[model samples]
Target: MEDSTHTGALLVVGAGPGVGMAVARRFGGVPVGLIARDEVRLRAMTETLRLEGRTVASAAADASDPTALRAAIGRIIAELGGIDTACFSPLPPVATIKRAAATDAEDLLTALALVVGGAATTVRAVLPGMLARGSGRLLFTTGSGALHPSPERASPAVYTAAQTAYIDVLRRDLSGRGVAVAHVAVVGPVGADGHRPEDVADALHDLADEGGSTVLHLTEGAR
Candidate 1:
């Protein structure tokens, strides 16, 4: 059931399919703002939610571009009034994936720009209002490499590790401030190994509703 006391809108960065859309759907009871690079996909997702009787808005911006991303977030905040929950779950391009030994500096930089840079930009954009309100939820979806680094997936691992560290610091710094920060690390690929997107969304929803400093290592059949 949706909490009657919480009325602020949700802003979803990297609002693509799978986990992104699932998170939006899970929070459908409240007004939602979607952000992604694809304008067409954003329009389609917006319409889908609207058709479901949901209050939703969308913007197209590449997460890796801080200027564009901040602008997109600003537009959504204007449309939705205020954001109480923000989720960051961008999937890096397949071309960026490379093993540690094989990865060049350029490859690592590109991944970092999308993963760490995007998360930081989104947090800076939303954090001030949340701090003033003394309540909000900052949720992040990352891969198992974040917690247990894999040399086979070096680019993603490095960025996610940094992101996880950022979340940990925020958890400590924001403790008792009424805002909650949570990280959900998927131990396996979604849609395979029984790790469904809906389940991930469910976990994120729980974190948003029950404010706390939590790091949930999500695996198949484990909530």
Candidate 2:
């Protein structure tokens, strides 16, 4: 829905070639705004989506930096109009995926900053508009680690747990306010069996249409 007063754009944070690209593509007519730490990837994806005939905007911002992330989002909103849906797809830092015994204070802080803090910053950046509009979607793509953790990856386990909890609380807080907060938990790598990135994108569309807080578990042969 295009409006001269509101942007109603889809903002994909951590817009990589995988789900991010697929999600943007699935939105079809809606303008898509993409954020990523890799400028080259951002530019390339923007171009690719444009070639595919989608109106798109790209900004480079690391997910862990709240200020940079917010600034990038602000630019996107300014350029595209407004964010109708915000999809957070970034994962915790690579260093945090080590053994439990190897985890440290810095690791914990980094994990929390990106997973929990980043999400908060991103959501806060757009919540005002969403609330004003009385309808919007906040979507998070997390690993199955959030629900069933692997002891080997201590940091992800911790980060995902916190991320899930924060989303859960947000969903409760926004209930009946006409905002939809949903989580998509992938049991394995995003592309499995017949489940392509476009399929995941389709799932996101379905969740937004449903307009409520819920989690969709993705696995092979389950699409």
Cα lDDT of model 1 by residue, 4-95, tens digit? 56689989999887788898877767999999988998899899888988899899999999999999999999998888999999876568
Error of 1 at 200 (Å): 0.4
TM-score of 2: 0.90
- Give the Å shift of residue 29 in candidate 1: 1.5
Pick the lDDT winner: 1
Task: Show the colliding residue pairs in model 2.
Answer: 7-82
lDDT per residue for candidate 2 within 128-212, as digits (tens), equals: 9999989888988777666777778888888888998998899899998978887876665666554577766666666774544
Question: Candidate 1: which stretches are off by over 4 Å?
Answer: 1-5, 209-219
Candidate 1 to truth, TM? 0.91
RMSD of each: 2.1, 3.0
Query: How many clashes (backbone N, Cα, C below 3 Å) per candidate?
Result: 0, 1
Q: Once model 1 is optimally superposed onto the true structure by TM-score, how far is the C-alpha of residue 174 displaced, in angstroms?
A: 1.3
Local accuracy by lDDT, each model? 0.82, 0.81
Worst 10 residues of 1 by lDDT: 214-223
